[model samples]
Structures are given as C-alpha cells and as structure tokens.
Target: MFALKMNVLMIITIIMIMSFGIFGETISKTNSETKLIADLLAGYHPKVAPTDNGPVQVKMGFDMSYFDFIDEPKELAIAHGFVYRGWNDHRLQWNEADYNGTRRVNLDRNTVWVPHIQAANSAKVTELLESQVLVFSTGRVRFYQSLQIEFLCDMDLTYFPYDKQSCNIEFGSSLYTTEHINLTASPNRGTNGSRVNSAKDFQITTLDVQRSEKSFRFIAPYSFVDVTYTIGLKRVSSVYRAKLVVPSVLTSFLILATFLLPTASKEKITFCSNMFLCLLLLIAFLHTTVTSTVETVLGQLLAFSLFVDFFATIMAVVSYNIKNRGTSILTRKDYGIMLQDTTMDGDSGMRAEKTLSTKFAWLRYIDVISFIGFSIVFVIGLAAILNQRE
Candidate 1:
C-alpha cells in the first residue's frame, strides 16, 4: 500500500507541473520574454548632445502635407507636417528577431528625450500624436514624430486681393542653449510638398529655406540657430477682380457720364453729390475690410472723382446764375425800349445776345474738356494699376 500511494502522489505532482508549464509558456503572461525589452527601454536617454562649439546635431526636416491660413486678425497660419528629428541612440537597440520577432514598437514621447525646439515667433504646437521607434539589427533606431503647428508669421499684403505675400515659419531652440541642442532644417528647409498647390486663396509662388544665426542678449555669447521658411503667396485675384474691381469700374463710369445731364436741371447737383457720397462709402468699406487704411489705385481714382464732381457742382451753379442774369437783362432792356417807343431796340438785342455768348462761351464746351481730362487720368491710373508689382 505504501508503494501504491507513492506512485499516485508522484503522478499527481507530475500532472500539476505539466499544466503549469503549458499555461506559463502560452497563456499566463506573468513572465513574458518582452520583459527584456521593457527593462532595456525602461530608462533610456539619447547619448548624442551638444558639443563645445554647438549643441548636438539634431538634423530636422519636415514633410509639409497640409497648410492653410487660419486667422486673419492675428495673422496666424496652421501647418500640418511630419517633423522628424534624427540622431544616434545606441541605448534603444535590441535584436527584434530574437525577441518575439518584433522589428519596431510604439512608444510614449515622454519616455524619449526629444529636442525642445520652438518657433521664434512664439507659434504653438497644437497636436502631437503617437511616436514610433524602429530598431534595426545594427542597433540603429529611427523615430517618426508628427506635429500640428499654429504660428504667427510676418505677412506682407501690400497688393491685397491682387497681391502676393511672403510669410515665414521660423524655428529655434528656446530651452536649451546652443551647447545642448543644435537644430537644423532640411534642404528647402522644408517643402509644401504636392498638397499646397491647391491652397484656396493663395498659391505657393516660392518655397525658400534660409538659415541665419543671432545672439539674443546684448551682454554675452548667447546665440541661436534658426531656420526660416519664406512662403511666397500670390493671391488668386479672379474673385476680387470680379466682385469688387469690376463693380467699382462700372460705378466710376456712371460718375463720369454724369456730365451729360443738363446743367439747368436741379437733379444734376443732387446726382453728383449722391454719387460722390456713395464712392466715399465704398472707400471706407474697403479700408475696413480689405487692407486697412492704405489706398489702392481704385481708391485714388475714387478720390479724384470726388474732386471732379465738386468742380462740376460749382460749374452747374455758375452756369445757372449766368443764364438767369442774361434773361433778366434782356427783359429789363426790352421793357424800357417799349416804353421809349423802340428807339434802342437794335442796340438792346445786340448787347443782350452778344454779352451772353462771348462771356459764357467756355461754359458751352466745359463738358467736353472735363471728359477729356478725366479720360486721360483714368487711363493713366488703369495702366499703373494693371502694371502693379507682382
């Protein structure tokens, strides 16, 4: 009986051991082989850092897939791109094939020591998604990082709707001195890639990347390396040309045509005054909405038209006074001659008619002269605007 009990006990112990072994190998992850990876990356920081002359070289480049103007008030531009920072980190390396056949892994950004670069213009980063770390057999690792940037850029909008602008995306290190981290941009510093060609209001005219160095303080050697991306933008003028320019031209034409109205009609003065007021309102609206108080060719022309209309108003008044005075003189002289039995009839007729034609003769041709003068100015203004800086 003792021998039989020993055999039973040994069998039971063996079964328990086998069951635990199978479960431990495949089911229960309490003791995983990945623990080796965890321990290796548990506390790893990049070894490469700034040298004496410069910070450790952190080669920076971007693939700009999306870009748009988000705010007009603050002059803010938003760019969606992949900014990859490359460096040598022997610390984050392992034989992935030997370790569960893993070639890469997704890691937390905080776990890795990344460059702390900022936009020189105080732009902010909006989104920072998941980071990826890839390991090769040679202990080389590459990190893929993404960022969504919203920054204030210097925008030159001189021509406005018919204008082209050059804006910049400048970057530099804020926290680290030049000794700790040297940030450099790639080729054209960066590219808008293929997607920016379809920008709505602005077209990419030039993508220029430039590198410049500056020392912030007045005291010592506190210098920084910066990358500037000058994006040349040409306004798609078809919309403004159709919406504002065409209508303004037509309105100006109407204003010029006002001279055809008979000077005797009371509507001539009122009409010119009303047109001038409307033109002023248009100028004010453009100033408020388009490009501040700066005047455009159209604005200049509008101002000139106002002056022309004011002169027309004066001429209208003068002509009316002349006609009325001529009529009064003729009536008085004719009545007096009738009272004197018509001895001065010939002289009276001659004096009344001759004085009116000779004195006010210029008034008869005033409309033609005004039209010619205005036409010359209008043509000159049109030519100048058409040849406005590109």
Candidate 2:
C-alpha cells in the first residue's frame, strides 16, 4: 500500500514540473518579441507641425548603428548627418545651435537634418535584406537602427486646376491658359558624405492645400483643403528656361518701323532717332527684367534678339543717309558707284536718242530695285522677330 501511494505522489510531481517549464518558455518568448517592437518604435519619431507663417514644420530622427553599412565606427557613425551649425546653403534653413552638443533643428522652415544616436544594446539587422530596400546593409556587421524624416513646405494648392483651369496672365491682356511648375529638393546635412549618410526613407507627410475667395472665405463648400503624401525623389533646382517673347516682338517691330519713316528731312531723322531710343530703352527693360535672373539656353535666344536689334539700328541709320543724300554721295563708294550712275544718268536724260535710249535707263531700273530690296529685308526681319516662340 505504501509503495503504491509513493508512486502516485511521484507521478503528480513530474507533471507539475513539466507544466512549469512550458509556462516559463512561453513568457520568455513573449518578452523578447515585445522588446523588439519597442526598440523599433523608439527609433522613429517624425512629426509635422505648424509655424507662425502658415507653413508646416517637419522633423526627423535616426540612431547611431544605422551607419554600420558604410564601415563607420559607432562614434563616427552616430555623428554622420547631424546639422551641428548653420545651414550649408540657401535652400536649407538652420537654427543657431550649440555646436558641441547634440544636433537638432527647427523644422519651421524648409530643411533636412540628422541627429546623433546613443549606443546601447545595438544589434545587427540580418534577416531584412533587399537590394531595392531604402536601407543599406552589409552582412559582416549588423545593427538595429531607426530613421525619421519630415518635410516643412507649403502645399502647391490649386483652387484653380493647375492643368485645366484658365487664368488670365496679363501683359496688358487676359487669355485663358494653364499654369504648372516643378518642385525639387537638395540635401542640407552631411552632403559631403551624402552617398553614405542619406535618410533610408525620407518622406513628406501632413500636406495641406487650401483656396479662398472673398464672399464666403471660410465656408467648406466655397473653399477646401486637400492633403496627401508619398515617397519623393529629390532634384536640383535650376532655371529651366528664360522667356521674353513680348519684349522680343516689340523690339523687332521697332526695327521695322524705322524703314517706314521718311528720310527726306530732319523730321524723319528725329523720328528714327526717337524710335531707336525707344528700342534701346526696351532692350534696357529686358536686360533689367532678366539680369541676374538666370541665363538659360533660351536666354541665349533673347540675346540674339538684342543683337538683331543692334544691327537693325545700324541699318536704319544707313538707310536714312541713303534716302537723305542724293545719288551723288552713295555713287562715290565702290558698292553704289554703278547703281547710282545708272539711276542718275537716266534722270539727266543727257544721252537719250544717242544710244537708242539713255545712259540712265539702267539707273532708273536700279532705283526701282533698291526700294524693293530694302522693303523685302525689312519685312523678313519683322517676321523673324514676331514669330519667335514664347
């Protein structure tokens, strides 16, 4: 009886031991998973907030072990992309900060930044590896890290459809036309090591675009705001082209008008001079509008217009001289010698009937030809100027 009782006691003890062991293992696994998730959440803390001037502020954060992919020592890697001082360029707005301390930025303006990370229980990331993934990784040394990024910018709001709406763009007239633009970005931190220190996933979030007109400014039906975000690629900001079509057309016309004026008296000279002066003034206006603005391939085209105008002014002066002076002056030059002799001798009629005609028969023909040639040149120059693409 005693032996049987002991055997029962032993069986109960073994079952209890087995149950305790299973329970302990389950709790350990649960704790490990929770720790893993907590560590990752601690790393990402990107936020977007409002600034005084109505633009949003974006801020981002990242940890030190993140740089191991590029062979950086933990100390150096943690300091990889911090904005310790002022912004490197105009595109980035940085706050004046204590350089020796941790790097931080005010996202109240457009900028990109990175901050130092702490080294504690850092582990290598091994399982997650994909060539297309934003994170860069090397198998040798792995680390668990986090990254945060934000954007502070005004939404490109289109109360008027940017692609379809017709807006009157005035150079003294209103025409229905569509307007569009391209936006781009530049790195503001660790640019020298940009290839290695860039954010794994820099993203824009919390965009707000709104439009309002006077009568019911704040009402929802009358006005609305839209918001959306996605991964974005950064591009260099540059002037794609320079367009000055109206000014160019006006300049060309001024050149042509010089031909229409009479050069028989000082009035014509004064008029041509005034027109020339106005053209010069217009060129100056164009120069002022475009100077320091940017020089593009299109800018070179505008320059060509200026050159054509300069040549036109010279031609105008030359034409004025030809018209005011009689055939006597022009005939002395080698170019006009034959032309004038032909026209003038014909006017004299001195050799009429002697040669079955006059020596000036060709001269009369020359006069007709000169007028026609001048008119043709003027028309062609005007057409070229007016036809330029805006």
Clashes of each: 3, 7
What global local distance difference test value does model 1 have? 0.66
List pairs with backbone clashes in candidate 1. Answer: 49-56, 50-55, 50-56
Off by over 4 Å in 1: 1-37, 41-54, 94-102, 122-124, 128-146, 197-199, 217-222, 321-331, 334-355, 364-367, 388-390
User: Candidate 1's error at 130, in angstroms?
Assistant: 4.7
Winner by lDDT:
1
> TM-scores of the models, in the given order?
0.74, 0.26
Question: What would the per-residue lDDT of candidate 2 be over residues 1-390, giving only the tens digit for each residue?
Answer: 999999999999999999998887667655544443343235333232112333222222222122321221121111222211111212222222222121222231212222111212123223232211111111011122233222222221111001011111001001111111111111232222224433332211111122112223344233211112211222111121123445544554454454444433455456556655655565565445333212322233334445544544555465545543533443334332344355556534343323322333443344345445645754664454334221
Q: What digit string (tens of lDDT, one per residue) describes model 1 on residues 171-211?
A: 67766666676667656536643455336877777766677
Error of 2 at 207 (Å): 13
Q: Give me the candidate number with maximum TM-score.
A: 1
Taking all chains together, the TM-score of candidate 1 against the true structure is: 0.74
Local distance difference test scores for all models: 0.66, 0.32
